[model samples]
Target: QRQAMANNSRPTPTMAPNNSLRWERCSMDIDHLSLHCRQHSHTVLTEATPVPQWIDDRVSLTQVLEAMQASPMHVLDTEFERVRTFWPKLALVQVALPARNVLIDPLAFADLGDLGRVLGNGRPWLMHSASEDLVALKPLTEHAPTALFDTQIAAALLGLGSSLAYQKLVQSELGVSLAKSETRSDWLQRPLSAEQIDYAADDVIHLQALCDRLGDRLDRLGRMDWLWQDGQRQIAAGYELLPSANPHHEFRAAYKLPLAAQVRLVAVLEWRERTARSTDRPRSWVLDNATAIDIAQNPPRSGPELLGKLANCRAFPRRQVGEVIDLLASAEAGAPFQPAPAPLDRETENALRQAREQIDALAAALALESSTLCSRRLLEARARLGTWPPDCTRWRQQLLEPLVQATLGASSPTQNP
Candidate 1:
């Protein structure tokens, strides 16, 4: 029949949509699997001899520009350390074009101006789990990726595993599992070992292919808007070493303190930041939370008495003794207060609880952790500002705001209403 002829004539490609071969799941042989992948794949990692690090360093930057110009879309990844703070310091940067992969050493040559422009050029940049990468690079570059795509966003919409690992995504789409040996490579070192180099290269090289496959599926599923909104939220959140953040208002009743009490907390917070930066120690070490609370509760004036009160605190280094004493004096004099964590009433709570429910529902529908998508602080901001989460300003507003409205609309029937 005509239908039979039409079905038969729809030609299957020599390989897959990603140009990687579909290995017949039979005898389990890693060698056969690698062979199957390379023969039919256009992926960067499919190269028999992986170009781990950039060779011929003199013209490498120029070559990267050229390689990137031809291929407008590249994948980027980074490694860094930030166990102590909210932001990670970008230690290494990896860029993968469709045809090449190279890892940049941030420590060796800190100047990445050209590279930053290239990344920020409004060309689409793909990353998996992009939040950490965005935070790490904020200090180093003026512009983040202007056009960003998160493959994890796409995978979630496709009904794939909600928490897809990087390696699994590559394997699921590209049919290759990268070497696990270099999972902990210290990327900041120069003259990277062969294993480390290969691992780093593999980290980025497969991203484009994964993005392509996932992006196509996203388009087909009509979920591209979701991914776009998700990326925008992260892009707006930014990465900066803020001098001070108020933890006092973080508590419920404490937020209702008199203006002077609030001012005291802020002054103490500013002092803590200054001390931490000057000493290059952790913020908590500079002044423990309990100590800050105590200082704010009872404004300690100057001299031997104040010093003796804090004598039990061994963390107060000799270098900071004078500074700490001065900060106490400053707080005691006069401190500027910031008002409003949230209005203290049932109405505000209703609005906030509503925002939280919407966020929770949307997170479930999209298969991401709610906390990961939007924090409680952002939820409070939304309630106080009478707006949805910032990312909801875009395409997601229609989809997500309704749930927020439902939250704000009616109290529990169990209430006196």
Candidate 2:
């Protein structure tokens, strides 16, 4: 969650027209609707059904779980702080079911494993820009969600901008501008103010209806199945590099370095990862990227020299500096550095330029973003290596491969490596 605090400011449950109300009684209270009202401001919120309940215990969680199971879909959102931690510190979780919306306080309720089971039961989970929420949900659920309906991704397929904000998306599609007064609030603090609670609730309050609208739009366009497949593809792609032994996988900018520097970078990053995990602190707090890269590039010969080289190294135990020095020495001595293959030659480089031009034209013609076709890095890699990423889905290949191959030419010298 972004710390962009401003002020934020629910619906009633009713029985279905044709179905009996035996199993679906509205248990959440809506008498305190002013809990969501703005006291100081004159802004009037749009009328919506589905009252919210503040849930801070196991009983409330069970109640919400049963209600969610009764509903066909649910909206989910989370508020967390990640300023100085490797993992998100989950503070609040908002779940909006058809019957009512509820807030889950993770700090007060420690055992949420059952709630996780409910979320992981293959029911559709509606969220906006779900990547970070997916990370936050993993620790609670013991696994990531398999069924996702990301409103942002769905909107993108409908020709809305790919990076649309949640508030903007709701306003554009639903015409309701959410107040952002609490975007930067400290969610971990106890005794949350009414304003804070309202702000957090606003995150998921409109999600259920928003998902329904987007779903209908996608279905009419005959792209609903494609969106579902793409959601799964996104989940699979996110987990691809997460389990890698390469500690430097997240440092995308560092990959452009020479082969030997890359190896040394990996060594330092691996040590940093272990240290951060052990201490439950951020990797930067242990040794930031710049300092690590400096140590890797210019190894320190002695303990005193290491101290001199790293002014910020005092944060960690002095013994680790000695260990790092030894690790660098071992790495340097164990292997003779060999550079990776060169980038595209002159002819291939020109062809790659032409390919990008063609891709841009194709994207414009198809009313899609260039990134929706393929990322620049992926295109460059394909141009250089003469092959696509193994994980590229069949749908994407159908759209991209023929054009790329035509641009590469049949007799091109850049064969698959």
Candidate 3:
């Protein structure tokens, strides 16, 4: 199926006369069309929107790479489908260069390692909400970019807003209204619709302009390093392949389980994680959280009983019931289970409150969002452990350490009445 698509091609657009700009239609196939432009001078296309070029062939991809090499930075975005899979399936990649915009079809090429290398070659990538895109690109690019500028994070740091949607940010920052009708369209289908192509093109088209305006604000605020720090953190998290070590902790009710049941829960969760990755299915499909918790709370005596418990779980393998029974038995007989940490005690709760107040004051002084500085979960962990959260960035820690220390000190048993 893919070979037929790869074999398809159309003639390249002719260049315009010197010192003149011209828009030419370039077709990748009968159903897929792209627009290319030829210009004498290199300038960022902010005022006039350009149609995205369709690059499905090696020659076209190479030409795009050459154009990218001459530029210091590029704006990037991706469209993917992850509804039924453990990993994101890359459908399309949109890139905005100084001269042109192009959409590369991942389904047409057997290998994209070359494109990945070029993208991760240390040149800055300007993206909005880059976490998922980074993960989607991992199969093609093994290494993350050395430098990244996430416009969403940059805006949040500047007190603009937190978790702002791409369209909203573009509208607010650049006064550009982008259509969102094709957001839920299926990208994996062959011969993507013209609306889908246009929507994909718009995703990265104005990213450079938005980045320029937000970046200047960040530079003036002296928070560009902070944005970079957070960007790197996002990259690290996105590329993480392993499931969380403490998967059970993700459930709010896991803390209520007895020590042995909690141990069983952890084992089951880890098994589910491994199974999901190996089978390329979602974790919930292998074993729903509620079902896992139920099984852990009430250990089935035999495979029949386990099967009965999983009657409602359509995706769980019926043949694995015996295996799961054995796993539960082993967990029950394993070494003494470490009791999960109890909920925050009164003193610690007070400390968390104090720490939050301090953070609010600090944020106000810095003119930054409090959540951007520290999340409540991180604060609770800090107050409970009397140490900085491991994920806390250096810049944030430097600004927040004194407040954390003061809060903990004030709540110490010796100091408290």
Write down the worst ten-residue block by lDDT for model 3: 27-36
Candidate 3 structure lDDT: 0.74
Q: What is the TM-score of each candidate against the true structure?
A: 0.68, 0.80, 0.85
Q: In order, what lDDT does every prediction score?
A: 0.59, 0.66, 0.74
How much does each candidate deviate from the true structure in C-alpha RMSD?
Answer: 12.6, 9.2, 9.3
Score residue 222 of candidate 2 by CA lDDT.
64
| Candidate 2 wrong stretches, greater than 4 Å | 1-46, 237-259, 312-318, 332-346, 409-417
- What is candidate 3's TM-score against the reference? 0.85
**Which whole-number lDDT from 0 to 100 does residue 373 have in model 1?**
55
Best by TM-score: 3
lDDT of 1 by residue, 1-417 (tens): 123222322111111234542222122222111111112344333334334455324367768767776665556888776644434656677887544466676765647677666666655567887777887777665866554577776676565765577888777777776678776656555555666655666677666567656765665556665566566655656544444355566656666656566667767777767766665566676677667767766766655655666644544576666666666556552334455365548977866776777678887876657765566765565555556533443444454556665655422211100
How far is 344's C-alpha from truth in model 2 (Å)? 4.9
Q: Which regions of candidate 3 fall more than 4 Å away from where they truly are?
A: 1-46, 332-338, 410-417
Local lDDT at 388 for model 2: 67
Residue 97, model 1: lDDT of 56
Q: Which candidate has the top score in lDDT?
A: 3
C-alpha lDDT (0 to 100) for residue 111 of candidate 2 = 81
